[model samples]
Every structure is written in C-alpha cells, then in structure tokens.
Target: MNKVKVLTVVLFIIAFIEVIAEYFRIIPLIYVFKPLISIVLMLLYWLSSTKKETLFFLTITTSLITNVLFIPNDLKFIFVGLIIFVFHRLINIYYILKVMKTKDFIPVVLASVPFLIVFFYIFFDTDLLTKEVYYIMIIHNSLISLLGGIALSHYIMNDSSRSSWLLICVLSFVTLHFIIFIEKFYIELQIFRPIAMSLNAFAYYAFYRFILIIERSNSN
Candidate 1:
C-alpha cells in the first residue's frame, strides 16, 4: 500500500508538471496528458487492489480535464458544476433506494435545473451539439456518477448500515471545500492539487474503515 501511495505521488508530480508546462507555454503537451496520467495512476491502484480509490481519482481527474479543455465561461462552469452535482444526486438516489429509504426529490430537481438550462443553451447557441447530443452528455455524466458513486460506496463500505454514510458526507465535504479553495485563491496549483488529491484518497480510506467498523459492530 505504501508503494502504491508513493507511485500515486509520483504520477501526480508528472501530471502537475505537464499541466503547468502547458499553462505557461513552456511545452505543448496535449491537454489529454491530465487524463492520461490519471488513467495511469488509476491502473496502478487497480493493480494494487484499490479499485475504489482508482475510481475516485479517475472521476475527479476527468472532471477537471473536461473543465480545463472545454474553456467554458463562468456560467458554463456553474452549468457543469450543476451537472456534477446531479451526478452526485443520482448516486445518492441509488443508495437511498438500495437501503429502502425515501429520497428527497427537492435535491434531485434542484440539481437538474441548471444542467437542463445548459442543455438548451448548447443546442440554441452553439453548433457543437445537437439537442440529442446535449442530452447525451447529461445522461452520460449522470450514469458515470451513478455507477462510480455506487461502486465506490459499496466497495469502500463493508456493512449494510448507515454509519458509513457519515464518512461519505465528510469526505464529500472535504473535496468540495478543496475545490472551492483552489478556485477562490491564486495559490500554486501544483502544490495544492496533490494535497487535495491526497485528502480525497484518505477520505475514501476512512470511509472504508468506517464500513469495516460497522460490519464488525453488526456481526457482534
């Protein structure tokens, strides 16, 4: 596990260098470098039996790459954020249904509104996407989020109870704050990006630990 963590750190360093190099015009690496490094890191983790960790890293890396590569306006960023939020909602929905709990529809409806708006805007304003294709992105992202979230939650968790949910909420909040902090400040991207990544990794680990604890409790 320590070796896997070390490799993840190294890959993160390589990704940072690539992203910075492109940002400063030092070298023209493809924007795909970010996702490529992410895929490499994820593959390493998967080989090491850390599939949930791999998925978390891959999802965040893809989201960041999409944002950077698309060069969307502020409104569009908000639009994308809403899309991501809906993805989370979809995951939360699956979990709720799995546990036979009622889902709060307000959250689901609220999350979808922005993305729905973006869908129309893309169709009417840009030739890049036909109406059908725009909905495809929405469906595609939501499905990714749903599968990623459910698989991640289930893999990291070992119990059929609610205790792990607390860890999930905590970890999600940490990621949210990390993203917001980076956006709000002019800090060194390379320095803080890995720290954020590490937090996410640890949070997932903690979430798994919570699951184990709950499993033990239930068994006893």
Candidate 2:
C-alpha cells in the first residue's frame, strides 16, 4: 500500500489497540493523550496538504486567549469569560450559516469580535498575568494546538476556508480543554479523568486521519 494508506491503517490500529487497552486496563500511559493525538492529526494534515497555508495570526491570538483563561479567577471572571465565549459561538454560527454565497468578509470580521474580547480580558483583566519568558511557551503551545485544529478543519470543510477553519479551531480547543480541565479537577472521579482523555486522543487521531484522506484526495 501507499504511504497515506499505510498511515491510515496505522492510526486505525492505534485507536483499536488503545480502546482494547483501556477496556482491560493494561496500559499505564497517561490518559491525557487525546489533545496530543489531536495535535498529531493536525500535523499530518499540514504535512500532507500541498496547497494549504498556516494561519499564524489566528493561532497566536487563540493561544494567548487560552493562556489568559488559565489564570486563576473568581466567579466574576468566569461569568465574563463565559459570556465572551458564548458571543463568539453565536457569531460563529451566524457566519457558518451564510458561508457559501457570502464573500463579503463582513461575517469574518464580526466573528472575530468575541475572540478579541476573550483575548483582551485574559490579557488585561486577569491578575495572574505574568510577563515572564514562560508566557511565550504557553503561547507557543496553545498556537500549535489551535493551528493543528485549524488545519484539520480546513481540510475537512473543503470550502468557506476562512471562517469554518477559525470557528472549528476555536470551538474544538474550548470544548476539549474544558472537558480535560474538569476531568483533571476531579482526579478522584476515576471514570471521567483518564478515560475522557483517551477518548479525546482517539477522536483527535481519527480526525487527523480523516484530514489526511482529504489532503490525499485533493492532491489527486
């Protein structure tokens, strides 16, 4: 078989094995492998696709927001952040609905507002802000993950490249992060922690393979 096909088979095998291992509790690997798996999928997409370009700016922005949100906060900040995330989601849905015939770019601009609010609040309002060198690491890691998702969604959507890519990337990170964060917080709840992490990783790997298929199809 060809390289892409080999890769596809390999991912499926990995997923199958992971599920089996999880069922029997034979493996001791960290359960948080899902996000990393998602990142792997994204990297595969970027490497396989010949026509795509990296959305660096958007990745940076999303990463910064993630770091900011990681800051400790009371209910007040949580409420504000939730509101911002909701606004971002609403704008994203509106843009998705009109993505096909709408080339105006207004929707793209509108969609960015909520994200901007998120980043702004994290950067300016959070007391946990540290301008130390490590913040760069946080930014870098976040961007890589976000960019990976963006690349995957880009390959999946296959159209309306600008908006769908952004929306998916943001939403995926938010969804996965929240789930993982909650799971970590409840370490005693053995059912939710590692299992969710493994599933997240599997989901990410599946997505990565799917995008690889899409990239191969486009190349042909």
Candidate 3:
C-alpha cells in the first residue's frame, strides 16, 4: 500500500496499544495515548482520499471532537458529545443518500423501524438520564440506527465485487455504538472495555477502507 494506507495501519496499532494499556490499568500510557487515538484516525481519514474529501474530513473531525468530549464522564460533556455526534450522523446520512440506490429506499426505511423501536424502548425505560438528556439520547440513538440502515441498504444494493467492504464498515459502526451504549449505562467490564476501544478503532479503519474502495471503483 501507499503512505496513507501505511499510516492508517500504524494508527490502528497505536489505538490497539492504547486500549490494551487501558485494560491493564496502565494509567501513564493511557493518559498519553487515549487522546491521540481520534486525532490519528482523523488524520488517517484525511490523508486517505480525494473523492468526497470534504464530507469525509468533516465526518472524522466531528467524531474526533465527540470522542474528546466523551473522555469526561459528566452528563454535560456527554450531552455536548451527543450533539456533535448527531451532526456527524447527519453528514453521514447526506453522504449515504448521495450514493443510495432508488430501489433500496423502501428497504432501508423499513429496516430502520425495528431499530427505532428497540432504541425507544431502551431510552424510554432508562432512569439514568434526566428528561432533557434522555430525549437527546433517544434522538442520537435513532440517528445511529437510521445511518446503519442506510449503510446496510447501500451494501445490499451495491453490485460491485468489493461491496462487502461497505457492509463490514457499517457493521463496525453499529458495533461501536452498541458497545458505547453498554459502556455508558450497563457495565464497563475489564474484558469489554478493551474490546469497545478496539471496535472504535476498527470502525474508523473500516470507513477509510470503504472510501478507498469506492474511489477505486469510480476511477475504473
């Protein structure tokens, strides 16, 4: 691979090390590497593409901000992070719609309904968040479900040989968010925390790969 791809691999290595260090309670290493994870992914995304460059840049930058804000465990910080994440989701929606197949529209919309019901149940029953924050969380969760549905639909409709990469990227995103929900409310077990962080890094790497694959297809 090229320089950007090499850099992407290096970033993933750094992220994996950071997560492992956190799991082992290596505080000094965690403090040094935790904040850099998103920055490295942002740069990786920025360096990896020419097509849809603006949208990809904005998406990763907003995600970086959201991740940074999430480092604080306060409700206020989480609320702000949710807002930023919502913006990022909106951008993702726009990008997905741009390449969406007409035939996939109804399928995508239908697929989102079940996810919406599940998230509504989770958010509505939770006593962890205040009323305002609860509503924000519901909205954020809904957007994530919608984005996943769109990505899934796109992957299904895409006929290209490498379309499976798109599906993998979407799955990584869904997994990352699902782990975030568990980490936020239920339990942050020792085993799961590192897995969550690994998922987060994988989500970014997979998205970068998805973009590269799409760019190559378009060029051909």
Candidate 4:
C-alpha cells in the first residue's frame, strides 16, 4: 500500500485506541494517545497532499496544540488551549474569505448577530465559568458562529460542485463545538464523554476530507 493508505490505517487505529482507553477509564493511556490523534492526522494530510496550503496547515497545527494542552485536565490550561483554537478559527476565516467569491457582507453580519447575542446572553447568565473565562467563551463562540455563517454564505453564493462538501465541513465543525460545550458545561455523564470525544475527532477528519475534496474540485 501507499504511504497515504498506511497513514490512514495508523490514524484509525490511534482513534480506536483513544476511544477504548477513554471508555475504560484508563487515564494514563488516554492521556498518552488522545493528543496524538491530531498530530497523526496532520502528518497524514501533510504526506498525502501535494499542495500544502498555509492556512490549512496552521489550522491543523493549532488543533494539535489545543488537543495536547487539553490533555492536562486543568481548567486554566484548557482555557489557554481554547485561546489557541480561537486563533485557529481566525485563520480558517482568512482562508474562507480568500476562496469565497461573494462580496455581500450584510448577510454574513446579520447571520452572526443572533448567535452572538444568544451566546453572550447564555454566558452572562451562567455561573459555570469565571468572568474572564466567560468572556473567552463568548469570543470563541462568536468567532465560531461567524466562521459558520461565512462558510454558509460561500456555499449559498457559489455554483460550484464543491459547495455541498464545504457546507458539510462547516457544519461538522459547528457540531463538534456544540458537543464540546455540552461535555464541558451541560453534562456530567462520564460514560458518554468518550463517545463525544470520538465524535469530535471524527468531525476533524471529516473536515480534512471535505477540504481536500474542495481543493480537488477547484483544480479540476
């Protein structure tokens, strides 16, 4: 088999192991393997694709950093890690802006406003996080919503074959974040946490594939 196929196998194996470790409450194993998911997937992408887009690379790298930092299980560390993820989202926005053709900015602004208001309101009312962390959460949610809206706008404005895949990728990202919010704040069901984490990892892989599909469509 080729290198890409080999790497794909490795990535899946790693993901499976992570899920098992998390489900079994093997804290030591989970700590070791969970962070490697992003790193291995990033390597797979780097090896498989000839075109190395800077924004995509940065997104994956920051994601790796976020995953690694999150393994510590400290609120402060996780907060900092999420700050890095915000940078990841900002880079993604820059990339989306570059590829998207529609210049109608009003729709993007209007789409983001409702989500921004809702998130701010929810965070303002919540006692789950400190004031500083609450502000960070608001900023993070706002950027994620803005990114989703921008991606949706691109799909709406474009007539390309890749639009659907692009939309799926954006939706996957949004879903992953929503699950994260639930896992952190809304739920304490330990049995389901592994499932949520696995789903999050799968979403990242799906996002990578959709990006590759879009790039291929552009090339064709």
Candidate No. with top TM-score: 3
After superposing candidate 3 on the true structure, give the runs of residues whose Cα lies further than 4 Å from its correct spot: 25-28, 100-104, 159-162
- Expressed as tens digits, the lDDT of each residue in 1-220 for candidate 4 is 3988888888888988998887787888877788788788788778856676777778777877887787767988998998898888888777767765547888788766766676666556657887767777877888878977776766777745456666676777776676667667777567665776677677677667766776666678
- Model 1, runs deviating above 4 Å: 1-9, 18-30, 50-74, 88-220
lDDT of all predictions, in order shown? 0.46, 0.42, 0.73, 0.74
Task: Give the TM-scores of the predictions, in the order they appear.
Answer: 0.37, 0.38, 0.86, 0.84
Candidate 2: residue 67 Cα off by (Å)? 18
Candidate 2: residue 8 lDDT (0-100)? 59
Tell me model 4's lDDT, rounded to 2 decimals.
0.74
**What tens digits encode model 1's per-residue C-alpha lDDT throughout 1-220?**
7876687677666666654644454424534554455456555545454224333443445454543543332555655665664555454445434432324444444444544454334335544544534664456444433433443444344344444554364446435443533443334454444444444444434433443344445456
Q: Mind giving the per-residue lDDT tens digits that candidate 2 earns over 1-220?
A: 3665666565555555555554454444313322223343445555566644343222223322432342333445544444444443333334333322334444444444554455434444434433442354244334334333343444344554343434454455554544544443323344543454355444344433333344455567
Candidate 2, residue 153: lDDT: 43
Backbone clashes under 3 angstroms, per model? 0, 1, 0, 0
Of models 1 and 3, which has the larger TM-score? 3
Candidate 1 overall lDDT versus native: 0.46
RMSD of every prediction? 9.6, 10.7, 2.5, 2.5
Q: In candidate 2, which residue pairs get closer than 3 Å at backbone N, Cα or C atoms, i.e. clash?
A: 34-201
Which 10-residue window of candidate 2 scores lowest in summed lDDT? 55-64
